[model samples]
Target: MLLQLDIFNILIQGGKGLKPLAYRMRPQKIEDIVGQQHLVGPGKIIDRMVKARLLSSMILYGPPGTGKTSIASAIAGSTKYAFRTLNAATDSKKDLEIVAEEAKMSGTVVLMLDEIHRLTKPKQDFLLPHLEKGSIILIGATTENPYISINPAIRSRTQIYEVKPLTEEDIKQAIDRALADTENGLGKMNIELSSEAMTHLTQATHGDLRSTLNALELAAKSTAPDTKDGKVHIDLAIVEECLQKKALVQDKDGDAHYDVISAFQKSIRGSDTDAALHYLARLLEAGDLISVNRRLLTIAYEDVGLANPAAAARTVSAVTAAEKIGLPEARIPLANAVIELSISPKSNSAISAIDAAIADVRQGNYGDVPDTLKDAHYKGAEKLGHGTDYKFPHDFPHDWVKQTYLPAKIKERQYYHAKENGRIEQAFKKQYDLLRQAQRK
Candidate 1:
């Protein structure tokens, strides 16, 4: 096996670096890993295997940037094994033979086979004997569900474990590590990442650690140091530029930032087409396409709600279309949605009702689920009085039954107070009033 390249030192010594911050900052030991405590935490499955020196061929499947490759690296680091990587999808059978030959001679080489589900039959045949003999410890990494995507032949020989998406804290921890490690990170530089910038990084990528680190690195390099402080102050703008999404002219979470979004939503809720269009243009001009989609969707269900169900549905379609095509052209569908939502009948009945119910739940003004509404599938369910006297609504003439589904204490509590904003809502209110009267009686 070839020696692992030290791209970090190469860059410091005036060489063109090849490896990314994510690859360079990979955990050298299992303990150094940021997250996935269920597998890599102290005395966890992977940890136990590493500590006992009894590593087995295993499949790690999960979303990308969730540390599947990092797990393989950490295992190799912990075990002091010769680690070699090859893409099963692109690499040929000859590549597998080379790794196998090395494993035979080198003793227990860790072969991190990427896209393991894409391993062709010929390559699988070549690699199986080596895996069976315990010469090569196969660490198969893939994004697909192994049970469904992987061949049974490979599945039978490997223990499968999921690598879950990183939590916000996990991504933050990794970022801190990369920013602090002088040998492999940007520790030498005077860089200060702002709080809102950090939040943007953590939330915008949706639990992707790789994207966060890379974005951070990009911000650090691209942003110039402050003349007065001599610190590279990476704020939301620089971070957004690095992300290529989440654009903000005003500092994120600032008064002006909140004001713009607040006014945008309120204008739509107030049914002012001109004002809504103006705010929409401001947001679009600032290049915050994501924020536009989010607020519009919220307004669809929250503001335009049950008053015009079809209009709200159309708003969703508009948002989806805008997201696919993006801005300039996205402005068209977004404008159409704005106009329809502004001119259409509006209602806050659904949002108000749900919020009221949520408040009660939060206050602990509830009780245990009634036995009549409890599951009766199990053998002892009837003995426990579960499903006892439970009426099947479908068996009734109107497909309706006068039975409480809520917990005992909250049986009479109403959550959905329908409005008379539109014909549909009026009809719903009529049905709801009738149902409540019968049930209460």
Candidate 2:
């Protein structure tokens, strides 16, 4: 009992002592949490779960600095569970075994696993039984999407929730909490942050609360108090010194990756050069050249199809060059491809026409092949009237004789609705219409 009391005292003292500001100011309760309103706001899913003490195996996925681990910790605190933390990058199977053993003795253990995506397959397999038996309520936290990075067996056992970046107001509330709470924050310190300093840190961190807190801590700890007032004044200059260039929130393997690629293709289709280039740069910076190549080729064929065949051909060449040259230098050719495709005339008619025909076929609309259209190369094909009405188009002017090519059911169905966007497709529309007219006559 004395030993337990001593450990508890030490924990209490630690919160008031030399822990980093970010560590000290972590929310201990759900209400104390400053962001992730969608998860913890009034009547939110997480709020209800924690309130009912019904914590289960959950995977929290989001960008860095979005309180995933903190929320897990808060849930454990709220539910009065024995909290245990582990880093999948460093902890091994033995560590998991120890945690599971402890949970067997304790009522419940809230195991918050950081970078759960990095958990080895063996370790994840080991954790499966513990999770099923409820010995440990696993709270897996990762910046990567669990569906993509986690083993299927493990992902199937957990509920996945996405925690997005905090809003500016939420971040500000967090900062205020840190400054006002004397027990676990910088409230005890005589420090005053200028308005400009607040704005600088808030804007520069780009919704990353950890980054904001760390910068605030650095400026607080390093700056000396003014001799006149005996208070540390954190100004814009100090903020500038502490703030580094923050990259945009991007998950190369998660939903953001697909979202960015989708936007890039749409931008090209809509002829928005600037937006297309922006998304191109994002992919390049993330070193996702493979996705870049695939998305660019898809855009070329799907969006730029039939409208500008030259652009389509050029996009293929650019992808080849990108593959040959590789990144850093490769982004140049990729950017050129994106720009060219963005400005090129857009057309979905070709794909739409094929898809319409395919849909009909899928719905049991298969029609018999026209006797004239059927091949007569077989020994007995002539006896079946296969080539009886077949016209040799080469024997006519323009190598174009009116003939029934389509299946009889869809022979006259207008499938190809050409959009007059570019010169090539325009010329194609005229010639194609003339051919249809000739066949009707």
Candidate 3:
């Protein structure tokens, strides 16, 4: 209990402006929120609730610096509700009682609970009655998925919303706002952020606005003032220093981006596990998740097809899991996918078969459908000779009755040539060879 109060008090330190620049710049209204337009955009859930005067408990889950706490703060400010901050991991039951007493006196209080995934049963028990009676609105913030990490009792009471990571543009807007806001920002310092520095600040942090803002502050404060212009200049070097990451030019539009992506896929195709992982790490460091996910999925069906069918299927599943969780933890599922794909026997036979079929079609080589294979359900179809001489294989032993099925012009056409590259595909080839022999009759 004593430990809990100590940890909680440490976070609740000092007057406004004394805290971090990120804390000072928290949105005071839904309009002031920098990102998370899905939640606070026009006609969105949080915006709609604010506009409609329908306040409810909600759990905001996402990667950090994506405006979970800012949303809670904005809701309180806009609704004119008394706001209090607590740590579910550190704050105790007594802390909940304090918020409840305040809520009772003030009609309603907005309790922004950080790390709500760590809420103890005692603290939850103390908060439940107030939450039920509408005296306290709980805005639980967590990086973990609420469904998996939070207790069901609390989970059942709150609307769970996933906060997406901010885009480069969104982070740029926030940095611009911080640069220009005279009251709560560094506007008075005459700090000039170079365009190169701005790009690094926005893109290199992987959309972490808190890290971007603080790093901007550090760069501005640490650099000596320019004597000629009387302005503090923050350049790319200083930003790289503060961020502790080299600004690798990994923009989606650049040639380097495509180069990295090509190397990543080719490495896996060549069955170089370590090399593939190295490229994956580079892409991840550049925060190129979309491309990583996209390329991996494409490789599954295109490169790793019949050789290891289950591995291909699992690549899709791994990518889905990675997207749901987001990064740096997203790396885990992505890594699993990368390792499996790199070492798995590789093949492009599926794509090869499709390409062959497509080429023939493009050349206008697809002949008319055989009469026996044509649609025969309509009343006049059989009279048109469409269903004539068709053999229903289901009635025969082994379901092996065979007949001429392909069109006359392309009766000998064979597009899918099964490979014997791995155990699975070898088994597939064995069945395929058997079917081919039977079809020749």
- 2 or 3, greater by TM-score: 3
Clashing pairs in model 2? none
Candidate 3 wrongly placed segments (more than 4 Å): 1-17, 249-259, 269-278, 284-302, 310-340, 347-422, 426-441
Worst 10 residues of 3 by lDDT: 1-10
Per-residue lDDT tens digits for candidate 1, residues 136-213, read 999999988899899999998899999987876898888888888888898987889888887777766656788888
User: How would you encode candidate 3's per-residue C-alpha lDDT over 1-441 as one tens digit per residue?
Assistant: 011223223334432225667888899999999889888999999999998868999999988888999999999999888999999998888888888888878899999999999998888888888888889999999988888999999988889999988988999999999889889888888988877778777777776899988777666656677889988988777888778777665443335657888999999999999999999999888777877998999998899999999998899999999898888998999999999999998888899999998999899887889899898999999899997778899888899787887788888899998887789999998998898899896
Give the distance in Å from residue 125's predicted Cα in candidate 1 to where it truly belongs: 7.4
Residue lDDT tens for model 2, 1-441: 011233333434546656667788888888888788889887999899998888779999987887998898788888888999999999999999999889988968999999999998889889999899888999999987778898888888998999887876788888888888889777877889877667656655656898888778767766667879988888776766666432332332234556887888889989999999998887776555767898888888888899998988899999999987887899888888999998888888889999988888899887899899888998999899997889998999989887788787877788799889899999999988988898988
TM-score of each: 0.66, 0.61, 0.72
Better of 2 and 3 by lDDT: 3
**Cα-lDDT of candidate 1:** 0.85
Among all candidates shown, the one with the greatest TM-score: 3
